[model samples]
Target: MFPRTLLLLLSLILFKTTHAQLHLDYYRNSCPDVESIVRSAVQEKFQQTFVTAPATLRLFFHDCLVRGCDASVLLASRNNRAEKDNPENLSLAGDGFDTVIKAKAAVDNVQECRNKVSCADILVMATRDVIALTGGPSYAVELGRLDGRVSTKASVRHQIPHPDFKLEKLEAMFATHGLTLVDLIALSGAHTIGFSHCSRFSKRLYNFKSKTRIDPTLNPAYARELRGMCPEEVDSRIAISMDQTTPQTFDNVYYKNLERGRGLFTSDQTLFTHKRSRDIVRLFAFNSTAFEIAFVDAITKLGRIGVKTGNQGEIRGDCTIVN
Candidate 1:
């Protein structure tokens, strides 16, 4: 058996090897204009609709949460059972996929960048643009991730946090990704700009359990409004903004809403009800700058989770297919 000191050195060497290939300037020589090319393409899609911004942002988070930020969510398996096909991801908007496809096409059009840039990197860039264009901080995203080759539907099962998850469950889920309670609260703020299908949150408005009663934790007036929008046993396809106030903007209003019992998801409201996380929620509710800074830091760390670097994965020529 190897000595303890030798084992420690070996572990460090392995970690370094896995992460060594990912650098901010990985494309400096091969695709000098990759960012500009992707940005322009995503902007064109942004002009098409308001949904694109949140959709793209959700795509990035889902991509990272399930199988790391390797663009596996974009894959189209021949079996029609890729990660995106899972029921949990069915709510993910198509506009997000369109934005990334357009951006990848733009990259391919560039002379030196054709088939050189990874879809994973394009995803990171588009996510950054989504946040910036939505009036959030425009922080730098580190690049050089490789496209994942596997995207099984089974892989997506239980990977993302459910809307009904409680505070403890949410904390445990984020902890799996090396995220903290603060990260969970800050990242949940992404709900500020997105829409959710009635089916996703109807339980809180209708009979939460076997009893015919609305969730008491939810604001009664808001529950009535949601009930109108999503009548019991009606069309589940009806949608509602996760944040009713300034739904299109990306800000601390989500935290403020949580304080008012207007949080759309059970997991969201639990942050305020749970003693451990309530103080942090109050802090962000009153301080947009603090929320912004924490969000930027958390998302940056999230983007790095389980990232594939070096020869572990390939730079796929197409975002939808392994190559």
Candidate 2:
């Protein structure tokens, strides 16, 4: 039972964002092919750590947005050579300080590799990392991506899919990229780690029974872990996304949640209820290795979507600043 006082806090967060200082741009220029190979090597070395694609993506985007992806973020704020090469942003947001600076660092890494690789891969991967770092599924996507010369904040708002979407809406979005419903479900496997704002799932927490909020059907032990992270009455505004149960690592917990009827979002839980979606959910739950591989495949598939095959695009000499 929530005290009700907490529910009142919801009203405070309803104001629209004043507009973020950050926005993404797209380009048509292709980075030299070497960028893919080099970035992949960098990603592979850090695979075991909690960072990797997401962190690198962050560095890629931030750098491009600031100084054309020259790896400038790697440089130290104090202007020291030793600090410039620092890779700690992977572990710490903004190196555990200011995350915006880390966003800049992400841009830096991407630019440094931009001359060698495509910005598209860098941007797609960056979104994946944001999903991963927040505790969603981390799939392996393909590299050798090209750069975009004209990305913008408005594009992201219009282009990126939102949590509020229903099945028909999602299917259409994926279909735009030649994705199927199953792929949508599988792609959603990223929900394993990333979380949402309290507003995103407030209906589940406040409207549903507390027991429902703490579904007894879930992994009893894992449920405890969840409860600790999400107290019944705490700020639903900052509620962690369903993927947080084990955000650092990739695994079958997401599917398992489906089996237990604990899928956090309406979109997530829907997979288990529909006859068509159930099998994929079950398959994912029972096989961790298969899930990881499939997840990667799905991500790779998503990477190729919505691009101009012939001349729909143009490459910018710079990823962040543009020409």
Candidate 3:
């Protein structure tokens, strides 16, 4: 009887682990036009500023990586103790938060959908829409996430990958979230459209290893260009495109840039320099279709991280505050 009971328990656990309560049509009945509503809002924002694509994408990643995809990062605390207040998250663009807030407002404008959808789900749909708008794949997003009530600055520590992280550090961090090396490579492609503050990667161009002066991995010409754009005494807040080749397009050129030593971040170029991940980078660089497919699969899996369902969390009437 003990063995039988243990076996049954194990099977139940496995079932729960594999069957997360999220689906492409989760909001079909509660809010039939939820996806379109969020998509239209995102499109309007994207039209206003190209920053919408990368900022929203990065916000989704940061939110999911820290406390799952609960939208805790969206919460604002008057005492300035929320996750968004963390120094690591301070760089998150206001446009990202605005994108979700605007979409939430749009959803609530319709009587049937008012306060019916979770901010977490709105973020997921908005992320997909922005990606599609920026020439990335537009896959169906799995919904049904709920907004987390907790958003402490303490939770953001070491949760996000640093710009200078190497392949090993990156793999270990991603592994904790159930992401594979291929997933890491595929997701890094989001950098293809974003801009990074000079402080994030200036070390690569100015004081790599405190000895080489410049990171030897960077292409010489590219390094020179970066120096010109960000002089030694320039403001750290100066922005540089992550993918100089096609800053406005979300595509596999990020991998191609890695191959050419033009990657703006150490974490990015490491994907090509590290032997274990180099092959995957080469594959993505040469095959745009493979990159897109892997990205879609990876992001879908990412959306499943630490999700709340079945009364685990609440749907907030205001995305920036708990209901």
Candidate 4:
């Protein structure tokens, strides 16, 4: 009793799902395909400029990994963007600009990476490039994405996982995006190249108890930075990121920190205790070959959180704030 139009639509849906298979490079159908076109176009621009695209992509991942790729962190504050360098948080020695601008620089060194890819795809790919430029793995990114329009400093306030998360809260946050603690730490490893803002986790710097402090053996230089940022009078509610060492790189320095008992955040430290994930952490820290493979697996998994490709959802045009 179905109308011919309805029957045809149902048949097409059956055909598409049954005929398609998911690959890391491409998702099935209109949403994903549209996203892919943009990603590719932007990547080409970067290539033309002789700039590698992966490092910037890493930064986008850093921004999004914690709270779902909201561009609030990148939009650059009114005063800071015009005169100050924004990537300050990305490195203890950054060129003094927003990391996304660093990504844009790479693309500009080539052309408009954004024009080639969706704002979403360029956002992540450019950040990844940021990570690679440092020393981390240049992870292969999946394309075909849309930008979000509703990110809030508030959302950044509430959902962005702290460098100091314990296992349970860490797991819960990652789970929101279909990730796990293993994913959380691995993603947090993106921090290896970036510097911390004392405001992010001032408590750990000022009042960490040895029992609560995961890495009692932090680098002396790192300790100095922490002390300077927090000052003795600063309150605990301050926020900071964990990858003060190499914020722009995607290499195993983060794992290296984990190995040295120097990981600044509880989130990074949690990897050593989990029964299931500890090994992956050790694996990444010691074996670059293994870490690269594991990082790809984890990042691939991370990108898929809550997204509906292949009938899950549509690609948006922007990535800064989710509408």
Candidate 5:
């Protein structure tokens, strides 16, 4: 048997080999203008609708969390058995899919770049562009992820965090993807610009626990405001901004809202209520620069999850259907 030290070294080498395949310039030779191409397409889409920003950003997170950023979330099975068909994913905005599809078309339009970039990479670039478009910090995105061939709805089960999740459940789910506590908190800040369906959080305002009809952590005024917007009998599809204060901008206001019991979801509020993460929440709430920096770093790491590189997957000509 190999010595313990040698075994440890070999494992480290293997880990690096797998992850090293992705980098800032992965398409430097194959698709030299890939980033700018995706950015332009995303910008055009953003101009058409503000939903492009939050939709695309949420798409990236859901795609990565479910299947390691493989763009499997983009695959559509005619039988309605694909990942996108999953109930948890059903709410993913059509705008997000459109953003990636538009960007993919733009990338392939350039003769030399045709089919040279992966749908996964286009999704990544578009996500970064949207964040920047919504007044969030912009950062370089590592590329080289390939589209996976498999996309079963069964794969999405238990992969997503529910709106009612507490800190423990949230941490456990994120940990499966190798995200740390700080990373989880930083990434959760993405809620700054998105909207959530009323059904997702109405329970917190109505029948939270046995002791109280409403969640005690929720600010009474905010609860009243939410009730006015989302009556118990209201349509489940009604949407509310995740960040009430600065709903259109991607910033540290998410943390601030949590501080004031204004978070729209139990999972969102848990970050500030849980002792382990509260200080980080306060730190971000008080410092936009620090929040921006942490957000960029955390999202960059998030983009690296379960990526298919080298010979593992394909660069599809069409994003929605496996080529």
Candidate 6:
């Protein structure tokens, strides 16, 4: 018998899985090699550049956060503004967009699967590949998501949380998408493999608030190191690893850094200070497997947010524009 709380959590996940049209073998008959095809495409790009894995992973998070995992983030609007044009999303690496486009083309080349698979599904698989390739736990990605037809600049600004969000605001944002406090902490572990522009977190390095010149929670030495790398508004565009320990790997060291006031973003550091989420942050810092398990669970749930299904969206021949 399960504990009452455990049973309730299981029920919620079961309910979400059923309604989201998520399943393992959704493309078994239609496109049996879909996952492999995407894996190859992502791998090819990754070999050429180290950024591919992080870029692809970030693309998935941005896509899911704004409009579910519908690949709307890949849309290219002819007009002046679109989701990709939003200042929040403007930093999305072009290599990530190119990787998805290349993967979609690979899928289309298969005679049995030509124009049959959704770009949304390909993005999910590519994200899984990114995790697997970067020494992280691999999990089966659910399929059957339809391609969303809509993408707008307004949604990106309204939906995505910035790096500076406080714990309470972060919690509310995640809650709106059916995620919990634990999920927020786990998903943040994705930072282990990515880089952030100094502009995103420079306030913590200098002039944080009236209380202190810099964020008091940040380690003084570490803040000095970041200052040398970023140097005020002059070099704000320079990128720095989120995980100073192992920049290329996806691991729990990000949480460990938070324990020592080395978290790069205000949002990252607050997980350690806020009473409600502090314990959760410590748990992941001490146990890598626990963090990986929670992350897989959180990402699985995240992929289902606001998904388009049934006859709601189309499978575009080219992922950049809706058919």
By lDDT, who's the top model here?
A: 3
Instruction: Answer with 1 or 6, whichever has the higher TM-score.
Output: 6
Candidate 3 segments whose C-alpha is farther than 4 A from its true place: 1-19, 210-212
**Local distance difference test values of all predictions, in order:** 0.86, 0.48, 0.90, 0.50, 0.88, 0.87
Predicted candidate 2 versus true structure: per-residue lDDT over 93-205, tens digit per residue: 33212222333244446654444433444445455555554444564444433343433322233334554455667677667655566567777776664445555554544
Per residue, candidate 1 scores C-alpha lDDT tens digits across 263-300 of 99898899999988887788888778777877876787
Provide the global lDDT of candidate 3 against the true structure.
Answer: 0.90
Per-residue C-alpha lDDT of model 3 across residues 103-212, encoded as one tens digit per residue = 99999999999989999999999999999999999887888888998999999999999999999999999999988787888899999998999999998988777576
TM-scores of all candidate predictions against the true structure: 0.92, 0.56, 0.93, 0.59, 0.93, 0.94
Estimate, for each residue in 1-323, the C-alpha lDDT of model 4 and write its tens digit: 22442343344335422102224354333233433343454445444442233334444554555445433344334444311123323332222223344433343344333233344455555545544544556655665544443333334444556566777877887787766554565666655654444555555555677764524545556767767767867664454445555544457777777665566666666676656556666666766655555455567666554332334332332323222
Cα RMSDs of all predictions?
7.1, 13.7, 7.0, 11.4, 6.4, 2.7
lDDT of 5 by residue, 1-323 (tens): 22442343344335432257688888898889889988999999999999999999999999999989999999999899999999999999999999999999999999999988999989989999999998988887888888998999999999989998999999999998887777789899999999999999989988777476889989999999999999999798999999888899989999989999998999999998998788878878887876776677678778889889767899999999887
Model 5 TM-score? Answer: 0.93
Stretches > 4 Å off in candidate 5: 1-18
lDDT of 6 by residue, 178-213 (tens): 998888999999999999998899888776785657
**Candidate 1 deviation (Cα RMSD):** 7.1
Clashes of each: 0, 58, 0, 77, 0, 0
